[model samples]
Target: MSGTSPSVAAGAGQLPGTGRTAVVTGASSGIGAATARRLAAEGFDVVVGARRLNRLEALAASIGGRALPLDVTEPASVAAFTAALDRVDVLVNNAGGAFDAAPVAEADLDSWARTYEVNVLGTVRLTKALLPKLRASGAGDVLFVGSTAGLVSYEGGASYTAAKHGVHTLAETLRLELCGEPVRVIETAPGMVRTEEFSLNRTGSQERADAVYRGVREPLVAEDVADCIAWALTRPHHVNVDLLVVRPRAQAAQHKVHRDPPDRTAAR
Candidate 1:
């Protein structure tokens, strides 16, 4: 469907996102934070939520958005966050991470639990809580910041992969359930994104995290994924971008990634 109708074109402001309200979770950093900034620039009333209130407040102040403390894992936090908002035209579910990369044989149960708790259960909790508001908006969007791990599997990433897979299915199921409704379920699966804390938190050390991208010439950054998200959200309400998989030029697939030779001189 075309986004440029005469009525939309004749609207007051230059931005298509004018008069929309967007709520982005996990907005303390990475893609979530970048999306908050981009949506604000797009003229949407942005509200950022995260466990880190200080950073959220700073981001809110910078972008003229609101900040609310949210821990998706906690029912109370999700309720409070939901209650604090009067309108929500878009919900960006981005609060998730890979905690460990242990193989199945050597899997740490605790790590597995945490992975599922944050990436799957927590996401569901928040989504269910805010779905009523999203439905009330009449033209709402639920966008999940999924990962390539959800699509394909590799060695030593079972915990993360499984959780992401859950996220992928969650988006799909929601789309089916919301058929004929105005809300759109979109999933942006990014591959090899090098965020400040993603690798560090996954590997548990700077050295190991550095090794994860040792020879990669260019890895996707948070902003790249954020751009995809904004583009999808700003599309015509009738257009539903079911799934968008984004990766850097260096990454062809989950198993295949092009990398340059290690820079020995830089290491020295």
Candidate 2:
């Protein structure tokens, strides 16, 4: 029944995120790493976590934050990661990836299971483990790095789409369940993001991954998504950004993409 104080409100001399701790999962590279860096610049004490301790440590050092090893798909890893944190004001659930792009008829059950385990189950595991800390922070944020695949179905994308759909619904359900709580549940669904390993990991080949974004102009990069995440998290505690959908200018929809002619592009 209370609201944010003027000193902590937007336009205050001190940044809204100052003194708070933000935890970003899958932060070794790509969006997670970008979000962690952006949040640190926004004045939050950042903690970067991922299975890659080397990368995480390097990133954490560059940003003047801390790094810890975390594999959300493993329960023991999740437990250890959660136990290591003393306080968490923000949780960015970005430790997810698509394994394959096969069609539903030719679905790889192993791929489907892996997709679900990382994107859906892993997110849930970390979120559930950190809810208490989030609630305790008084003004907490839980942001999910979702994909446009969650909003619609696409050919050869059922496995990833299904898992992202689960993530979308999970955010919705948590928001409803935490109606009166101080914690905010937010989801940022990005379309056609050109990250380093996302498509490469999904398609299993550099050529196939390159083909996924061969045309048009600039696609959304990890920094673009990270900007959205930081903006949403920095708003006044009472203002909850429920969902944000971002896409490249060349992308009109899941099925509608504007690609320039190859010859014209080459000429330019």
For 29-99, candidate 1 gives per-residue lDDT tens digits of 99999999988877789999999999999999999999999999999999999999999999999999999
Q: For model 1, state the Cα shift of residue 97 in Å.
A: 0.4
Cand. 2 TM to true fold: 0.95
Residue 129 displacement in candidate 2 (angstroms): 0.4
The most accurate candidate by TM-score is 2
- Please state the error at residue 26 of candidate 2 in Å: 0.9
Q: Global lDDT for candidate 1?
A: 0.90
**Candidate 1, which segments miss by more than 4 Å at Cα?**
1-12, 264-268
TM of each candidate vs. truth = 0.95, 0.95
Cα lDDT listed for each candidate:
0.90, 0.90
